[model samples]
Target chain A: MTGPWAEALPWVIALPLVGAALTPAVAVRRPRAAGFWAWGVLLVTAVLAAGLVSELLARGPFSYELGGWPAAYGIELRFDHFSAWVLPLALLFVVIVPFSWRYLDHVMPDERRPPFYALLLLNAGGMIGFCVTGDLFNLFVFTEVVSLSSYALVAVGGRGLAAFAALKYLFIGAVSSLLMLFATAQLFVLTGSLNMAEVSLRLAEVGGGTAVMVAFAAYAVSFMVKAAMFPVHVWLPDAHAIAPSPVSAVLSGMVVKVGIVGMLRVYQIYYGAEVLELGAFNLALVWLGAVSIVMGAFFAIFQDDIKLMLAYSTISNIGYIVLGLGLASPYAVIGASVHVFNHALIKATLFLAAGSIIHQTGFRTLSDLRGVARAMPQTSAAMAIGAVSIVGLPPTAGFVCKWYIALGAFEANQAPFGFALVFGALFIFIYYIRMLNAFYFQKPVHAAVAQASETPWSMRGPVVLLASLCLILGVLGGIPLTFVEPAVLDLLPLWGP
Target chain B: MLLFGLDLDYVAVVMLFCVGLYMLVAKSNLLKKLLGLNVMETAVFAFIVTAGMVEGGDPPIMVAGTSAPFASPIPHAMVLTGIVVAVSVTAVALALIVQIHAHFGTIEIDELKELP
Candidate 1:
């Protein structure tokens, strides 16, 4: 059973695709059952993902030819350690969607919910497929699946700004998708194969041609827009700030990271070390990253709205990953990969905790949040731990990422980037201190204690699970690093020691 | 007549692409913008189909009556999916714009920013 079924990598992606295909009918028949159906589908996908990982470990780098065609002509699904690990992380977030169902029901009225959870699960499946696949054109197809669902998810929550933010997302997504398609078209013209491995070999031969460079540029810039890199990062704060809390959780945690993975993959495979050995690409990314770090922090400082502030801080946090990628050392790549994994956990915890706060008190301003710690110590505690981690205190997941990233910058012979890491640490302190002051240290001007007990179990449970993961991943750091090191090693070149 | 056997779908596709992109960017009406996006997507679908076409190729579908040789179906497979996705995206974006109009009382991008 295991041997024959193990060959089926597409099942991991197909489960959600089929679920999305069936969603509208499910909602129309029994709207109440939609949440249950969504949960069941996502859980199946999660188990399938776990099973997929086990197979990959046993067999090593599983690839399945679509419709029984060979690699060159067929769309293939490949799951390496790198791609497989994102499975559980993505699955974990998908689990949070159903938990959000009851929570959202408490918030959003009945008229608002029919297709919502169905879309969420579909989007999750699409995100997982995007990460797991080896075909370049297939990757764009999965991207559109996720992107289209996201527009509706963002807009459906009934915030006036949510609609407009989704609109802005529409403009950007359309242009970026076109850019990616153009790049994909170029690759198709050049290699006549959609498979990544074959494309890599062909790309190496066609190395640094004008057409290839244009394709690389198009791919890079488009993915950067998705990753919300600075300058183009203008769309992020609004999208994050106004989107439903659960949706925000996914966007900040998983969606943006997928786009980063695309950039990193293409940079390594398509551009290679020789092109980067000349230092043009990394120079651009490093400067862009530094600017995002400083600028995102500065922007975060000024936001009065707490969600908006966190959104800006997310922009700053993503900067660390970009910086690590730009540094392009072994440790830097480790730092970047681990940072992606770590950011998902810590940021998910923070956003979910923030969601609980917004859900309970109906307040979005930091100043209005005095005495939240006493009022809701559970949530306050989670926020404190996540915030402290963001400031890069050791024995937390954030420390592992910052430690490697800062060291990676130094490894690249850039001491100033190391300093930039330290400065980033300091700014994290300043802001979280203010937030903590509002939450724990301040007097309760309104006596909001009785109203502020722990939130519903659904909200508290997911937030706790993620926050606990932050601590566990920090202490048991070597476990994930084992998986990540091999993956990152493949991406990087042998630098002069 | 035998000087050169060439087809000219590229010209039409390129022109349609330009016209669609211009309408999308320049139009103030949300519905029209959605139309533009659809037009652009169709134009792209045309290009993909053209790229896969051979001079005397059939529709690349199997039939019991005739196993006629046909153009590559790979691009067609991708384009079919693209068309469905394009429509899905258009539906979502149009829905968003409809809601935007309800709230801000205008479909114009310039006017909406004036809202507090």
Candidate 2:
């Protein structure tokens, strides 16, 4: 809350990084000890993270030059409500990461557990760095930090299909990262400053240029690829399906949401109102968001594998964010933004719950899970809450996000997009209802059922807690939206009375 | 025909970027695709160094008798981070590729997908 703590901003990225480095040092001493220590480190980080967010909110948008130098002369790290929100989620993922270690150990061989936790912590660092840094090149470096670690994580979970899938993901992530770096270089050439604020200022001076638009497109496409938007989403289902459940949850919840955040940051900073208005980027966003909604749903319905079904469903839900982005209005953008927070909580819960079932029963196919309800009532209950929230049902966080997006669409006079909103809701119903029905009605009699008892409390507790939060946040939504609304208003043209 | 004495350096870097991007897009081999990515990254690094080079700029590192910080030091520092990232990616990518080989017994994209 003090005036700029220039030295401290990078420490937000550094805390988890230092924790990651120390993880193996401690873990190698005693494998069991590593998990508890990791959780404590992450928990302290979550507290520190809360302090930073409060500081950022009080002071307004804050930038710390990485060293003592002025922002334009050094890599600048900036934080507002946007990056502020992303940092905590990354930290919380670290908090719950140990529970996942227990779950993954059951599914993976002994060799992977230590490395997986190490990669997970490193990823926490990378994701934080990506969100907090205001320097364009730093953003690219952190993107690699997350990607390379994620690719390794994916390989451990999947074998033949997963290996190939990881490769595809590697290719896509590599290409996008290259495009991102190139775009950053282009900006550097034009502006002579890698600092985001200065870049925006200089670009405004140059104004309406081919190179800027190309750079914008490059950022947007890269973000979309990472977000797993439909069409560009070829590698996603296989990747998610093959990944161990915890990895799947993290990939779906934290990893992809980071991409959406990145794109929004790019637009708000680089494009702003001046270039955004000229580009009509809103129209283009709406266009893709619309297609991704319907197409993702259609694809989701055809998947026999439950994870694949959820994977496709993830693509559909991301469309809502895309649509909200396309709406580019304050309320709509808020809808999209809040949806990331809301959906990440709900989706992670569902995947963890589903993972509990998978770890217990070794069954992922829908047909294979006939009556899992009787065996693991708690996981099933969490899944139900997650499914309900995801469907935008009452008293769940998903509803608030949908309500805003719908209002945004109608407000924008984009009725068809409004229709797409409702249709997306219906698609949520079609797939999730089937999932629920399968859980309740389908008999759980597969061969994996004998070993498929419920997971221990460590694994189930995080899912349950998040599911409960989904319920509570939906009903008393004013608190969460307080941060989101202010952020959203900053992006809007027609905001305020 | 050259704009500056540095024209060839710029052109060569641009060509490397194009070649790498093409291989990244067009190549079917997974290893080559990753190689292309590294190639592209190096090309970008080269271009960035060129941008930092002014008419009389010299190496960024300050040593004995090195005065006045002739070249842009910022880009050089940034490239150090970039190179670290490149190496990290290459290590992870090659590791994943090796695992893929163990599982599918081939590194070719077409061959891996042929089963499913």
DockQ of 2: 0.65
Candidate 2: give the clashing pairs: A360-A452, A361-A452, A370-A442, A370-A443, A371-A442, A371-A443, A371-A444
lDDT of 2 at A347: 80
- CAPRI quality of model 2: medium
lDDT of each: 0.78, 0.79
DockQ, 0 to 1 scale, candidate 1: 0.48
**In candidate 1, how many Å is residue A62 off?**
1.4
Give a tens-digit lDDT track for model 1, residues B43-97: 7778777667666777777776645667877777778888777877877787788
lDDT of 2 by residue, A65-121 (tens): 666788887778887778777554855585467568678676676555667777777
In model 2, how large is the Cα lDDT of residue A16?
74
All candidates' TM-scores?
0.91, 0.93
Worst 10 residues of 1 chain A by lDDT: A269-278
Backbone clash total for model 2 is: 7
The digit string of per-residue lDDT tens for model 1 on A1-497 reads 24554665778778777887787777775676777777788878887787777776676666788889888877887777678655656566665775586668655765456578767877887888888788889889888888877877877786567898998888778767867876776677676777888887777666666767777888988888888888888888888888778888788878888678788667655544233332677778877887788888888888878778888887787888898888888887788788887887787788888988888877778877777788788888889889888778989989998899899999899889889878977886788888988888887655454367688887888888778878888898776687788777766654322
After superposition, the stretches of candidate 1 with alpha carbons farther than 4 Å from their true spots are A1-5, A23-30, A271-278, A447-450, A494-497, B1-28, B35-50, B53-71
